[model samples]
Target chain A: MEKTARREKNIRRQVLVVDDELVNRRLLGFIVSRDYEVIYAENGIRALELIRKNERLLSLILLDLLMPEMDGYELLEILKADPALKRIPVIVLTSEKTAEVKSLQLGAADFIPKPYDMPEVILARVRRSIELAEDNIIIHETETDVLTGLYTKQFFYQYCRQHDRYCIDMKMDALVLNINRFHLVNELHGREYGNRVLMLLADNIRTLLNETNGLACRCEADSFFIYTPHRDDYGELLAEYAERFRSAIESSRISFRLGIYENVDMSIDIEQRFDRANLACTNRRSTYTSSYAVYDTQLHERELYNEKLISDMDKALEEKQFRVFYQPKYNIKGDKPVLASAEALIRWIHPELGMVSPGAFIPLFEENGLVQKLDHFVWREAAAQIKRWKDKYGRTVPVSVNVSRIDIYDAQLEEKLREIVRSNGLEPNEYLLEITESAYTDNSEQIIDKVNLLRKDGFRVEMDDFGSGYSSLNMLAALPIDALKLDMQFIRTICSSEKDLKMVELVIGIARFLNVPVIAEGVETEEQYLLLKKIGCDIIQGYYFSKPVSPEEFNKLIEAEQKEELLC
Target chain B: MLTIDSLREYGADVDDGMKRCLNNEGFYLDLVKSVIPDTRIAELEAAIADGDLDKAFETAHALKGMYSNLALTPLSAPVTEITELLRSRTQTDYSGLIDTIKKKKAELDSL
Candidate 1:
């Protein structure tokens, strides 16, 4: 019973019957009134007024060609001009065969003969046209984003897949744009304001499109994708777009990062093209000077390398592929060279690539947040080596392992370090912690507190690469550290530039005044070693003494130094 | 009364015409009665007198469709002739065709 009621209600939607003659209007109304709620208009002008008033409730229109004040053609021109009104199908009710053909050419859905001869044929044609129009409205709604009227991501990809040949023939390029820190805009403003901004952006992107061919899509939040014919100079085009965006959201101070991938590999899927362009956009995340990047072969290789490293990292740790190398620091104040301490550095020996430098993998691991695990591994290995040396030689020099910024944030850092020391039967003083100078500059209060906590627990803390960072002098005054390792760049240029030499001397003097020992790293010449020692530097570590060596070689050097001390 | 049988007597295929109207014979009869007095004939004559060939063609064509729908081919044939001539912008005298339509329309109205 409900189904029958719904059917009756569905079929009773208003159908507009327009004719200049009252008799013809009444005739059409009499034929269709049983299935529809018929509305009559004597001329096209009145029909248009009725259509505008009942645009939402109207399902179809039956229009006679010979009307006054506004002809059927004139009314159709107005209706089709409006996006909202065009969804309602208009079927021409004309007596002339020529008018039927001409009406169809002017975007009419179908034609019904006048004089009410074929009531059933007219009804069937009207029903079919309404059904088809409704289906089109549903499809259009699903394929478009309601907020921006831009193609949705799924439809955009499907369109690209279907039109691949068109793109190749046109020499198109794919560009992905991201609003930098857009979430901050939503938080600072409101979500409604963000929606308005997106709508404005969509309008601007539409202006950039070609009339017939190009497409722009809203891929996801704050990201827009476009495919257009390749421009001769994309950098200039992107600059103009960036400037436009900057002006559009002037108060928000928003910027855009655009990544472009020229369509060279036609065989690749459209989604892969978007992925490559997105990867290019991510490459600009850490940079501040530029807002656009084009995907190239070098970045592709680097991306592949990063993927390989991420997949291989766990296996590398389990297989013990990582080795720790120790660079010995000598106590330069003594007449005879004596071992004071060492810095433990990590090295990776890939099964296929031989030895991989820390430069290749450390930054990659740090980005992926896997450096903390590697840091713990290095700490445990260095502590165990120190314990072994103490057991064998009856004495042991403390070795410091480099800790990354990611490790400092770990809540388990203190407990993990203590566990490693206790498990190896080593004293807390036996292992030292070395943190880069720049790490102290980030969240200095927290880093200072952590360092203080570690020092109070008996572990010596040293600042590495001290002179390289901007806030070296300020950190020296603020941090509670035992020693300072001078940056290698300062030491390397000291022999060449007298100003650098003077800077080095001043640094050592500051360390001395602070009652902290100073170590100069990367010393390569005898003259540099002599000059550092003469300047009251307490320790030196570089190629001049010895390069970073394997654990066994470092133990042999320590044994040789002990024998030399006995002879002295 | 101008019934379906009367329309059939005037060379109108009432049976096929009724089928086209979804067998609504009363509706078809009412349409014929309504079209007999439509002012479009005067509009067509005025358009021809004004030398507006486009308007003349449109009015004649509309009348032709009305006659054809009722299957009144005898009335529709002469209007179709005038419509085609005006549509093609042909320089020909339409007096003979107009006379023939007048005669047919008088017969249709008499029914």
Candidate 2:
């Protein structure tokens, strides 16, 4: 912002004298000649042309009341209408004392009585009007955003408060409309191009303010905050805005997410209203989901729930409240399903609430970056459980645990997992890692490099939730993985829908080509299990066999596996 | 070679006019001499004859400002009178006032 702040460099002392009479132009010019450089325009037409060229350079305009071609009064009206020229103060040159009132009404800064006579009075009036206009230009720059003529945030907030005085009873909504992934647009097109986009957005915002009668401010760089009387047509308005941006950029990449706190609770602070609206706007900002989100009752409750989860997370982690559970995965290649390995899952047993679903907290933790702590907790706990089973059954049964994208980014992640395995008295193969397929699609080159490093360290990495994202078949070839774990949603309707079953078959075919096993989860019924087994899916984990259960219950399966009757 | 004394005889307020030109007598008389010869004085007469009162008012008003600025009261007085009449497009015998302005202009031109 400091780099972009505009600076005024030139000194302003150029005075324009507009009069048909040479005596008056010479007289006024001579009076101000010592302090200023005078530009002479014999009539209003010539003066206007000079003003257009030297609008910034001019300090003041001394206009005569009458001239041929264009009179001072007509010129005054023209000057008053132009935004750029109107700021330069004009002092009417007149003999008629009665014309003074009309001149003032027509926007004369002051009047200089017609006469070449008083240099002292003439210079003083000229100097005062110029000084006042200069000061006003300075103030104008501060109040307005340099790129957009919209008010700067501080002044915008001030003006919004002022609006309360006039329309206290009107129900207003605070809206925050954001350009999603704007930095990407900047990176793709240069910053100057980005500025043009912002300027166009500001123009659209000006139109919105005109229609709704509100106060708008351009927030830091890529968003705008508008406080206006409640309008229930935001859905249509957002669509219109989206269309405008789409045509402007000539690409569908110009998407926006608008959040509104409708009929705002005035009891709350204004900033907080915008904060809630901003929260709603960013609800799925990272994902290509909804275009607009209102901060409604449900979203408000969810906000509170997320807040509570954040507050209680640290305490829960320290208190051993998170318990790791294992869902048994059986090798389906044989006649009888034999227990192969278990997938580690977590269940939060809150002291007060008794049982908090992982669905309720995992996403919250993942978004806020507390998932790394929870992931580390599950990693260590699952390793210890594997050791416990090895001690009892005398076999190193492998257990796959989730490795989040955050963990893959962690430089210490491989070392941490190896340390867990070493401390648990197990091999790297005994402690498998499950990396989500979607995480591979983002930062593929980097995550692939890290996964290759981990694979070199002798860890088997399974691509978890294989069909969940835009995993191009080309990308699958790039991912360094030991197995493909079919996303459970694919299995939900596999028996009913031929497309889903064929999709699963296609994935299994790809797995076979890669020469890796396919582990299908969420196979709940016999029909789904038989169909998956027929498709050459090497493993299965679902309620048909067992839901994720306590290690104590899983120990029973381990005992059965030791006796060679795991599941029959 | 219009001196301040001659300008005063032509009914110019030399002291006030001098004060306006930063008390410079040379500049004040120069302005008075310049005011009498302004071509708009001729334009004002032409516009009056043509019945273009708007154009007449513009020219008369300009003469009023110039004569009044130099404090050439004899010329300024009649110009101002006709200027006011032309201001509202008041149709009247502006000829008498125009003649008086012309006579004062000749008096100033002679000075």
Candidate 3:
């Protein structure tokens, strides 16, 4: 009894009874109102008004065909035309069999003849129609996002899964769009405004995809994913969408980064396809020139390489696979070259891969925030070698170690360096610090402050890779440094081109005037070495003298140089 | 006086008609009385005079449905003929069929 009452209460069958004749309306009302709440409208005009007002409460409409002023047929057309009202099942209560057929063709739910048809028949048809409409509403709610009316992420994945075979047969592409710096926008503007921007973006995406067989979903905050069949003009379509998005959010200046996976493997899950696209998007985030990336085999291979290198870094460090090689700098003022200083470079020898160049892993580590660990290890090892050299030979050449940009932000940098030097019983000035010119790009003021503090504590600071960055000259004037290491590119081309040779001479001349010595690196040939010597460059460190060598070989070289000096 | 037994005595299928009304006798009786007072005959005549075949067909069809619901087959038969003619948009004199419907409706009202 309770279930029956509850079910009846939830039925809510409010039927609209439209007729011109009072007797006809009264008669139908007497029969139907027992089971349903009947709303009477004398004609189609009044029926339309009631429909608009009580659209939500109304489950079905019982329209009479012979009514005046907007007949039942005309009203049916109007209801069918409206998306909001079209879902309400309309039962045409027409006397004419012809009208019944006509009404059904015009999208009516059912037709009941007038003249007081069986109340049971009317109730049965009405109840079934309402039930079906309610079911549809429930399905619609679950499948769509309330704000954007796009498919929800779960529904989208389900749809893709269901149509996976179709997609593979048709050759489809999946694209993921991510808004750049969306969190910053939310931080600057309120979340409401951010939601408005998202809505506008969704509208633009829908418009762009109107012509294609595509499915779009709001995957997460500020991210939209689309799967579309492969089209010949897919690139053009994306470009157009980018243009539209830029216009829509012009005030916010919100831009989208898109990643597209065109070569889809049917065997993989749809989420995996989206992951590949997202990976491609992340790869292009730092680039300013392009707003999109296409996932390919090469990018996948590079990603694998990065993963392997990151995983192997700690093991490589623990095993002491990393060795410090010293490249000696020569002071060429006299006929016999004198060893002035050496730069400490780190070399990695992987057990399986043999020699892994610094270029391959250094940038990778820096990106993953692991380069700082490598930097500290190199610093400590180099300091220990300096101490060993001083103890064995009674004197040691000053060695400079590279300090990455990430290391410059370390608060204990100065303290760490002082500790390392003091533990070795060497003056801070005896150990040189080589900072790249590009490291000044990040927080130049802080870097300059740190450099000044290091110099005040008696450590020699050399600006490495001069002329390689855009603002090298500007930094040179403001930076307090002991020397400038000219980039190898300048030395490499100096022998081939007079223009390069002139540029090198000009740099050397400027360094001399500033009372800072210049060390020319990458001097592989005798001709390049003679050019540097003639230009009065203070130090020459390149392949011509010696490549970076192991600590024992470096010690032998230094001893040999001492013997040669004694002979002279 | 329009009782179910009396309807059956007048050759009306009261059982079928009552079943169509979900076996509610009161509601079925109301439907039968409602048809007795209908103005469909006059409406059908005026529609024919105005040459509005759509409206004519509508009124004729309404009369047919009312007679059929009460199981007044004789009254419903002539109306059905005229309704179909109007539905096909064929120009023909409907006066004879309209007269027969009036006679039969009066007979049903008396019963």
Q: Which model scores highest in TM-score?
A: 1
- Tens-digit per-residue lDDT, A225-265, candidate 3: 98877655655655675676567665656667888888677
User: What tens digits encode model 2's per-residue C-alpha lDDT throughout B44-104?
Assistant: 9899899999889877777777777777888888888898889899988777887887887
Best by lDDT: 2
The B-chain TM-score of model 1 reads 0.90
TM-score of chain B of 3: 0.84
Candidate 2 Cα deviation (angstroms), residue A415: 25
What overall lDDT goes with each candidate model?
A: 0.82, 0.84, 0.82
**TM-score result, candidate 2:** 0.50
Error in Å for residue A566 of model 1: 12
Among the numbered candidates, top DockQ falls to 2
**lDDT of model 3 at residue A319?**
97
TM-scores of the models, in the order given: 0.62, 0.50, 0.57
Each candidate's DockQ: 0.28, 0.42, 0.24
**In candidate 3 chain A, where is summed lDDT lowest over 10 consecutive residues?**
A1-10
Worst 10 residues of 1 chain A by lDDT: A1-10
